[model samples]
Target: MPDGQEVHYGDYVQDDRVHKAVYADQAVYESELDNIFHKKWIYIGHESQVPNPGDYWTTWVGKERMIMSRGSDGAVHVLYNRCPHRGSLICNNEHGNAGKAFRCPYHAWQFYMDGSVRQVPMKQGYDGVIDYKDPQFSMVRAERQGNYRGFIFASLSTEGEDLETYLGQGARAAFDDICNRSPQGEAEIVANCFRIIQHSNWKIFLENQLDAVHPSITHHSTGDAAAAMQKKYKDKTGDDAPMGYQFLADFTLPFEKWDSLQTVGFPNGHTQLTGYMGLRPRDPVTLAHEAALTDAYGAERMDEILSTNVHHVIVYPCLSVQPPLQQLRAVRPLGPNKTLTEIWHFRLKGAPDGIYERALAYYYHVNSPSTMVNADDLNNFRAIQEGLAMVGGGDWVSLHRNAGQDTVDNGVTHSVTGMSEMPMRNMFAAWKQFMTEGN
Candidate 1:
């Protein structure tokens, strides 16, 4: 769709490294919006966010505005927000009950919750000039729509794999990890979410999520402060600091420890980071929650479930999910150097209140707009955006650390070193494939 000089995929992304233009060039980003995002099953909204009939939430699928709404018949539909007539936004609000039908504000053209045309004023206005009965006159829907465990996604193109097949094992496992933890076998979205539009490319945030080396280096101050407070609390009260401190303090972990952890680069550009947080802390609240999980699933099954230790997973091109902590950040790229992230945390249904509190702390302290942890990351992302735009700066962004040490099997790459650039390389590989082969 974008036919510009720099849209050539080979020039920017390579086997082990990429050009800075991949992040800095407007042409490259536009190509991604068409080739990758529109062609693939981009995440739209969660079904849980619009549980009841007539509920709707507006979001973006690539550069196109979309509305994920539940119909009166209780079926979910992902429709383009544009009205068929004159291209006015069909659902203007971020989220609301469309009630019986969606009435476009521009012409008052109405459509059902499922996006079928219901009413248009003055049928005589376009008797022979337009075919009102044509399907094109209706509120247009996406080429494909999918719902996986309550998470919804849409594809603007008819080609490519079904969502389940597209996500593959690793990306699907990220959702499984979140769902399996709840005593009710579900995670419910909290009432609200935090949204921040960063001054950098969307890929930068997703890359940083699995970049083990940067956390300790970029967030050293916040980490050090939390670590110091933990010790001070121990000295003052003869008790360990609260679990919340560990949220910030983990960034102070030595490079040796970071290297000891494992990172799996899955097919389709997805990647996972293991061993950042020791999530299953033995405490009164956690013990109570464990009892609930154990009761829901037998002891052996509970152990089998809890034994799957994953800190975070990058759901390539769309989401960064921390299944263990019940949080997910969705990436929406606005331009080459601007990105919007929706920060949301979920409550494991049927778990204790204290367990939710633990999750709440992580959401507010680490992901919120006001937190120093996020501020630090924002600072660096902005700085990199500015630096890459410079004329004479270095051409390449290195993904060379542990470059040759990664092992590949069945299209997935496994990192020999925790801080390996395997994830970046893996993503670019997927990027290359998507852009070139259109798969």
Candidate 2:
């Protein structure tokens, strides 16, 4: 791009095999920041994160630091963190209640939650040098921003489809599964989250979200340990183990079951992995939660909502969600081989506290950075990046498993089997389009 040279994406991304350079090259990384991450709708913090007026959460859109804030009017706003005067960060911390205004740490330039300049210090200093009335002096907002089901997104580029259109049905189904479980038909964000910096390309993390092949192979030890613990608990207490242990034990499920599960890839690179492990076990706590849902929406609707099993949803290159468990991960690509993922879980607003506790257990044991499950996945991602650095390790990574057997209807790609590589190929198809089409 620097020399006006064309990037033949086909060289790196074939139908089934992707070249290593796409994951390792610095130039490719720069191009991704420009063409993919910046242009596409990237996930920001949820609306519940900054519920109170003047409350703000700091985040990133591509490499640029950003702030998501709630205004006095109760409207959510996203803005670049930089002060227009000297380009210093307005909110230095991750998130905090800026009660009245966002006063710059570098200087006293103040800004409203909506990014308009509330006041500029020493108005006489720029009498002739600048136009004080111009909106340019205020914080720069993202070119476009939208929220769907309380999830917030911001795009640096002014172009592209609206957020709802971009999310497609697969992603919409995920949000519905999450929200419909709550009697109030909404979910609230849990304050704290686990932040992990994975040493691999960002795309690799998204690819692994719906990948059903790696769980049994990479997480075998963790699965066995959990299963053993579960057995020990049942034998000693003469009662079934908690759902937490069962969650990990399911990872040891045979490949046949994984293959039976379905994977659907939607447009704009979003994809979904159908539910495998049954989550709706009958118990006192679960029954109470189900009763609450039933009361809110009646038996028939509650049955339809509870029966929709969604294991995972990847809102391509930005967010990975487990709507059934009320957890999602937001990805931030720091460099070619470095990615920051924030794992956040939610509480079903009107459901019983026990349900939130169940979600908490999954958040801690499965997605947390210290957990064996996530650690194993991170190690594999790093290893793949490291291997790509080796000259003789081969040039392309294969996505040939059941590649041609996928079904395509109405622009959606449905894998013939859950273990098929259709998800990877589908994502690359999007990657190639986002890179080549508009450039």
TM-score winner: 2
Model 1 misplaced regions, further than 4 Å? 1-7, 124-131, 234-240
Compute the lDDT of residue 61 as modeled in candidate 2. 77
TM-score of each: 0.95, 0.97
**Clashes in predicted model 2:** 0
Clashes per candidate (backbone, < 3 Å): 0, 0
How big is the positional error of residue 212 in model 2, measured in Å on the Cα after superposition?
A: 0.8
Candidate 2 residue runs with Cα over 4 Å from true position: 1-6
Assess candidate 1 and give its lDDT.
Answer: 0.87
Worst 10 residues of 1 by lDDT: 1-10
Question: What's the lDDT of the predicted structure labeled candidate 2?
Answer: 0.89
Decoy 2 TM-score against native: 0.97
Q: For model 1, what is the error of residue 318's alpha carbon versus the real structure, in angstroms, after optimal superposition?
A: 0.7
- Write the residue-wise lDDT of candidate 1 on 263-331 in tens digits: 898878989988567777788887887899899998887887787878889988999999988889999
